[model samples]
Target: MDLALYHPAAGYYTRNRTVIGPRGDYFTSPSATPLFGRLLARQLMDFREEMGYPAGFAVVELGGHRGQLRQDVLLEAPDLAYQVVEVGDPLPAGLVGCFLSNEFWDALPVHRVRVAEGRWQEIYVREEGERFADEMGPLSDPRLEAYLDGLPVAWMEGYETTLNLQAQEWMVQLGQCLERGFVLSIDYGFEREEYFSPHRPKGTLRCYHRHTLHDDYYAHPGEQDLTAHVDFSALIEAGRQAGLEPTLFTDQGRYLVGIGQELFAEIAERTAGQFSRERQAIHQLIHPSLMGSAFKVLIQKKTS
Candidate 1:
């Protein structure tokens, strides 16, 4: 299962030409508007100033879909060194600028597990007449066993869950690569408590196809998109173990407002046009009810 989704040769992301936005499967914050990138640039510039504006600091963006955000950052700050780290590859070592990822962790392949009869079991997928079906297997991975140990018994019982050990592995690698500066992660998720809360019985796993939500992830195989909600607590803990310090944790709206609200307000006030569609699009990007609140921003600083 892991090889199918993350293999360097024929993975969904690597082989497929289009996988982001409404036309492909779903839309991300960057797909919403340039405002997201612009606001992110504000945060990056702040880090640059903090680092004394190094002559060649790199703003490495992981999972840079179509490079729209990278283009936006370049347009806003041409002097800054920008690098896009493609998926399925290790992060560069000895970097001195901010690292960013939007909707990246969710796509990582997670091991599926379930607890039954006071014991945890791995869930495997088998080919069933040209379709995939779930099968029970032993929990051979120690990390997965440890992950289940932290969850409540009720939440684990008979409920499907994803042990996102891959995300943790990625963080360890990221911490090793980042010599200094921030690791900024923007995605839709919750802390460990809320993530495994009783309110969420089936766990945070879903599929997207042409903007329509579906639970039948096994239906499409590599044709549709599958993602699991990130465990922000795990990400932070892993970063700490890897020598990164947690700096800021907040919802996406607050992060944007702190960095880009002023710019957006100024643009709104100066516009003489009457309710232009472009203005509306920009508003939707930051509006409290839309992508603004649905997303979250987590920033961690690498200790020198």
Candidate 2:
């Protein structure tokens, strides 16, 4: 699964083709409106000020699909130094600025498992009649065993779950690469307790195709996108162990409003004479029903 999504030869991202916006499988927040990137830019500016205005700062964005956010940042702050580090790109060392991602970790391939007979078993995908089918195997990873053991009793009997140890490893790698800076992660997730609630027996794994949500992941193979719900608590714990301090945790709506509301208001007042599409774009971004409430932002700073 990991090879299919990340292999340089035939990977979804490495194909060098446009795969974002309405034309693609799904639309990301940055692709929807520049306001999302603008708000993030505001937070980056705040971080710069906190760091006493370093002579040179790097804003590294991972999984920057089509570089929309990077383009928006440059448009908003042309003088700021920015870098778009996509999958398979080498992360630079001694970075001293903000590292950002939008729905990146969820895209990483995860091992699926189901608890039966008081033990977790691996769920494998096999090609069957031109489609993928679920195949069960013995759980070999010690970490997967440990993860299942930590789940609540309610989730132990014939319930499926995703083990995203790769996400944790990615955090470890990023932590080591970042010398003194902040890691800003934006995604949809729930805290550990709420994440494994009894209501969610099947886990949060979904596929996106033509902007519509579906569970048939094998329908399109490499053509569609697959994602799972992030475990924010697990990420937080991993970051803490990697020497990164959990500085802030808030829903995307609150974070954006707290930082961008004043700027948005000022812009609105100044541009009241012309009710343009830009104003409409701003509304969509901050609207609670839209990307605002659906996403979340997690900020962790590395202790110098």
Kindly give the number of clashing pairs for every candidate.
0, 0
Query: Candidate 2 — what's its lDDT?
Result: 0.82
User: Considering summed lDDT, which 10 consecutive residues are worst modelled in model 2?
Assistant: 147-156
Error of 1 at 103 (Å): 0.6
Candidate 2 — which residues are off by over 4 angstroms?
153-156, 270-276
- Using all chains and alpha carbons, the TM-scores for the candidates as numbered come to 0.93, 0.93
The positional error of residue 249 in candidate 2, measured at the CA in angstroms, is 0.6
Alpha carbon lDDT of each predicted model: 0.81, 0.82
Residue pairs whose backbone atoms clash in candidate 1 = none
